[model samples]
Target: MTQPDFSQRLHGIIPPVVTPLKPDFTVDESALRRVIRHLLDSGVHGLFLLGSTSEVVFMDAPARREVLRIAVDEVAGRVPLLAGVIDPTTDRVIAHARDALAAGVDGLVVTAPFYTRTSQAEIAEHFRAIRVAVDLPIMAYDIPVCVNVKLERSTLKQLRREGLIEGLKDSSGDDTNFRLLARECAEDPDFRLFTGSELMVDTAFLVGAHGCVPGLGNVDPAAYVALYDAAMREDWTEARRLQERLIRVFNIVFQGTPRTSAGASGVGGFKTALKLLGIIEHHHMHRPNLPLNDEETVRVAEILRAEGLLPAQERKLVPGV
Candidate 1:
């Protein structure tokens, strides 16, 4: 398996893959491999495991390790593999980072410490410590919503200047901050700036973003790949058209509304859609995270049908129907 050249920049669509689970809540290796194959066939640029979409915060160490190992083996170096080292402290994150690197991942994706409030200086030290402890490339995961700490522009610039991080996956949803960081980082040809926003991929690209890590890419990777290609070709019209279509399909994330929480809605939606596409066998999320109910499953099926994702003959076939 040939690894990606970390010396070069990483760009294009990388899906934060959902971790498929069995009825007993164990990692479903077969279904996971199927999902990986489906994404690869769809022409995704890379695989991101143990991300928020993967429910890493809720999963234990064993489950996370299993997911990373399976992804590395299935991917076989066809593209770069980024495994999330999401923890509340530096030591714990370093532990996961070591495990992921040993499992053959090409890079590590880390977020600011959660569960405990951290100052900007402490956050910088967190990343600096990880970079010192690990030998692989590190990509900063800026998810302020979950981590409760924003990676400020000055901090990011400092990190980049000091070579503490090679890239960023900004899911902060702050357009102004994103653009500022993108503008400042534009001078470094090797600094990868990836938007975790599926809805704003075109806007991000237009402003010099290098790539995207969309959760929706797990469902329709070809669409994202097409969008990235169009953007790369500088065809804003075509890119916008494709992005709008994807946004419509992204509505499935809201299907659990008025009943389930947003997190449950998103995970259940993506897993159910995968099952409908016959890419995975089960749509079960991990324990404590609710799956879509009977009625919600029907709604998901309808959404897929309207989006032309379900086969005409199987339009009437709902899960457990």
Candidate 2:
């Protein structure tokens, strides 16, 4: 089979579209479609569904597919849609990959197998197995915080060289390390490198990283799109300004900490902001992962207000909401 090439379209602000939920914690397709519409309307470059922002690990197989199905249908190729086939083992990821392929995703975002540590070689083979079972463009998702293993720079380069993965989503939160990798691959324009550093989008683009997968983009996609636009124009000052403002907006993720899991706080704050913006109906999170309380929801709104995302004294939907 001829391998697909997605490196070109995968660049820019590809926010991990969060899985909007119901009071029952089921996937809310209607709200999800609305979220997709909102993102496209904001001129986002791409949509990453069933990602960490979508609570992929916490969802069942059916729910994961449902989110992918909704995203693929709603996006309809307007912007590239990348699906996360994340799981604990190669076979599990392959199963998710098959479902993602069947759902018609433009590409797949995979991680090293987690919960059972393996060597770098084993990780390479994990990605190889998925590509063999399901032919499609793949992006390595390097999120060591969740997976407990870093997809080393050397390993990733080898994968790209072998054409096993066409791009990378570096959520390792180590921009210094990523900086070197980005510089090394500066000549390979097709090997897309997107940083998940919610706070340093300007630095990412400044260092030759191709794009961003900011979780905060769920709350403010247009801001990120603007940041990317600025960086592309080489307007470092504007890019820095946008990134600095975004740093304040990122405070929402902290509102739920100490009271909830880091995952819950980050994702819940996003869901709450979406709810406040009227993009989604509810901010409900999956079980064992508590949703933000009324107090935290109010604080999220306050952050949005401070960031100019909402009217300072009023509570009304934003332009895109």
Candidate 3:
């Protein structure tokens, strides 16, 4: 096969799509394709599967490959598809990377291992090895909150110097790091940098970052697309306004859910909001994570309605318009 035209291959609203599961907790291939088509129809630039938002960490190897195949097939050249290569072990990550490439994915997004914190040097070595093992373009995921190792500016530079990594998705939610990266890799235009934080979409655009890979885009690809379009047109006001609305939706879905003694995480909230929007069959969460309660669901609906995202009296129309 020929080399992928990376310049033409990346950029814009790449949502880390949610992995829809059936009641039996098996991968729902049909629903997965539906979601991908929905995002593309809504105008996302690319599709991302098995990323952090996809609950990839909980998936085994077979399940991972199946999702990748589903993504590659469903996308069907209408848009590029990328898959997560985040594994706690280096060998597994290498294997997964090879598999993703062999499956004909456009690129790979690899997260630093979270189990047992590895030193910066060790982390650097890990990425370098995988870069050599796979021929696909790699985007390093720097979500320090989950993965203990933060992708240091110096380490990123070193990896670039060694020709091991091509891009980065910074979830550190730090503006300083973004500005530093823009200056450091200023010459390498193909060295893409994406903001993983949904809230920082505007800021990242301002700092010369290529685009975003937000989880929220799984539900609201329109908002992110509008934001990116606004940025390209230099419409800062409209861009910020759209971004704020997305932040509001995120806040409601993430916080309205009640917490258990173990403390609440927002994966359930995200899925619940999707269910409310009729995007998924049910707000089915994988094992060990609970679904949203009735109260949270009502609140999420209220927020969506107030935001005018769902049908209201004004936007409402008779059947078939």
Per-model TM-score versus the true fold: 0.96, 0.96, 0.92
Give lDDT tens digits, candidate 3, residues 220-255.
888899999999988999999998888887765465
Whole-model Cα lDDT of every candidate shown, in order? 0.88, 0.89, 0.79
- Residue pairs clashing in model 3 are none
Two-way lDDT contest, 1 vs 3, winner: 1
Give the residue spans of candidate 1 off by over 4 A: 1-4, 7-9, 314-321
Which stretches of model 3 miss by more than 4 angstroms?
1-4, 256-264, 313-321
Q: Mind giving the per-residue lDDT tens digits that candidate 1 earns over 96-200?
A: 999997898989998999899999899999999998998888889999889888998888888878888888999999988999888877778688899999899
Residue 100 lDDT in model 3?
A: 94
Q: For model 3, how many clashes?
A: 0
lDDT of 2 at 51: 88
Model 3 accuracy (lDDT, Cα): 0.79
- Candidate 2: TM-score? 0.96
Candidate 3's TM-score reads 0.92
Considering lDDT, where higher is better, how would the candidates rank from best to worst? 2, 1, 3
